[model samples]
Target: MENNQPIISVDHVSMRFNLSKEKHESLKEYFLALAKGRLQFDEFYALRDVSLKVMPGDFYGLIGLNGSGKSTLLKVISGVYKPSSGTCRVGGTIAPLIELGAGFDMDLTARENIYLNGTVLGFTPKYIDSKFEEIVEFSELRDFLDVPLKNYSSGMVARIAFAIATITKPDILIADEILSVGDFLFQQKCEARMQRLMSGGTTVLLVSHSIEQIERMCNKVAWIEKGRVKMDGPAAEVCAAYKQTTK
Candidate 1:
């Protein structure tokens, strides 16, 4: 697939965060606390020297343990966060399903949120209008579409958000642990829809801890550890390597 031409290119990307301790001294007590040494802020690197290329129609899996910067990398790719150093270029329109209901307004009705979410995913109102029925059916939220999102359960919100985010087929689809939501049946449905998208030539970048899901869905894999790529190769091979290291 390396010869297929890259749809996404991440070059030596690094993300850093500054952590500072808050002061808790009153004005009257400031003089007594002023003798404290200068506050030292620790710099945390979420992702360091990360680089990869994703080709069109490739189902790329990013696997890592908690705090391995998998989510940070996804955010950088989705433009939610900028890298401290390095370059990232995406060739086509991107739809990011990083967090369920992340961008939804709890006070808005599900119907309204559909348009809002769809717009954020770069879908025109007309496009959302055309796919409205399909999205509702997929989410099984037709009866609750007019109700405020706050009244819906978390799973319901996830379903609705997933449906809305996927209504418009994007050139690049980025998913971060979205499979952990909903019931077993809904998970099956979501997986089927994802298969359809991949078969239709959409590039997919999936971040998940589920090795089974990665093995079943992805052709290539990148194992990330401590904010760096530990290994990148065929899905089965990389997954095997990850399992060995973790165990």
Candidate 2:
């Protein structure tokens, strides 16, 4: 049974990072400045007063220009960063494909990385064993399963990561620019897999620069600019407005 409540809630969230102004030629200078308390810095807010609510089973898209906080918001929801203010609440299990090879060991074989990443996502060894073949099949990397991940191309790594993440239905799937990495055919395959997951009641939060992709796959869209949400509404309407701004 699908619940009427929101599965993900982000309320007035803000994230700030401190960046140093001085550039050091060497590590010694960097450490010396740090010890002398002479490291001048500035604060940059990646997200400011951003609030959002995603209903259960909703396919939500976040659209923004580069450096416009789209990925930051996903990171916040994924618990990769502590908000500078406000709160974010999530219901049920989450499978996050925030960055390619984020949870993977580059030195390990593709097959080994799958098991390692599965464990990180809270699956037992036996559960991973059961899904091993399915993941490999979907990844289409059966030939490279025993090869070290560092040897694979970016697209190949993305394939393995996507296959591992979506091996089972999760309550929420957070994707940040994942579709942009793979080839066109593989991208279509991933989209089909996501559609199946949505039908099975998985809520998805997607971040993409491709407005067309967002408009096609998402039911709702949020447009973020300069660390704040400029628009939030139906996918088509919001995407139309965002496109106008870019032109």
Candidate 3:
């Protein structure tokens, strides 16, 4: 299922956030700070000038410490956030499982939430209708589908979200630390589902701190630190280098 085609190309992309220290202060004070050339503002560069490529069917791993910009990179690729500089070209359909239940309505029933989530992912009502039963079955929430989402446990919500995400059969899938959800048995099922997607030619970008999971799941890895890529190559080698540095 490995296509020898490039699916994503990121060229010298950088993302920055400008932190204004005088948001609550008066305009005169802010102008005075600027006039004095001592403005108390900071620039937080979440992702420095970084470039990378992902090919179709590639299981790409993004390994980094918290605040190292791994999640930022994923968000950029998924079009949730735009880069401040440089260009990112993504081919094919993309599905991001970044924050589970991000768009769910707490007051809506599970079934209603499914439709809402599916619509956000670009599925038509007919398409959602076709996959409704399958999604509920996969999540093992058939009985709870009629219950309000507010009544569901966090684990239950995550399960439904995961099921809805994978049902789209997207060409590009970006998952950020989603594997930490659910019980042990459910985690196994999710892993199996991911394997199925990979084998079916879906390009996956996985961001995780778990070295073992990265080694087991990804064919290529990129290690990031302080918003920069420290190492990029075969999964085992990159992971090894990361471990040595962290230790």
Candidate 4:
């Protein structure tokens, strides 16, 4: 039974990006246009007056058509993007698997980047050392440990990234289409790991296009359409309504 307490709160959040209308061929030309005050920008709002709450231990899903601000909302919640208006707050540490290899150094060896990324996520050196082997094993890249990450395949990169992010339990887990990049088997493995984390009271916020997956894994769903929430409630109801519109 979830109380009224919210672990993740997004209140009237709005995100805006300024896009330049003209692209200058060189830096010199760009500066000249800027000096003349001739550059023009179009303001685009990715999210508009969006609000949401996830209580402790809730399995939340975000579903929408592409460019419907699903990923933008997740980025805002993860602190990667500051909301143009309103606010987003999280109660605890977050493990965000939003973009593949976003925290990794491509030029560095997998082993080196593991420690680097782990530390960035707030794990102490001693804690990372304890989970070092487990990370390598889960990614199944034992022989490639010393190899530079740039040489790794996309799937290989996804493996290492997912492995490192889930190595230690987190208070909140945010994933954005991360499972789509991996093979089916690896996706299944990820789902199993997420289940275990949820059982331990880790709140999950997931973005996936698969309605079937959402209904199966999430207790609640929010349908975002054209930068606003069109529906929010029990997963079955929201997902069923969303599916109807798409059909």
Best of the candidates, TM-score: 4
Candidate 2 clashing pairs, residues 3+ apart or interchain: none
| Model 2 stretches astray by more than 4 angstroms | 23-40
On a 0 to 1 TM-score scale, where does candidate 3 land against the true structure?
0.92
From the highest lDDT down, the ranking of the candidates is: 4, 2, 3, 1
Distance (Å) between predicted and true CA of 47, model 4? 0.4
TM-score of each: 0.92, 0.93, 0.92, 0.94
Error of 2 at 50 (Å): 0.6
Runs of candidate 3 exceeding 4 Å displacement = 1-4, 24-40
Error of 3 at 221 (Å): 0.7
Number of the top lDDT candidate: 4
Model 1: which ten-residue window has the lowest total lDDT?
Answer: 24-33
Evaluate all candidate structures by whole-model CA lDDT and list the values in order.
Answer: 0.88, 0.92, 0.90, 0.93
| CA RMSD of each candidate after superposition | 2.9, 2.2, 2.5, 1.9
Question: For residues 43-76, what per-residue lDDT tens digits would candidate 1 score against the true structure?
Answer: 8999999999998989999999999999999999
Candidate 4 worst ten-residue window by lDDT: 1-10
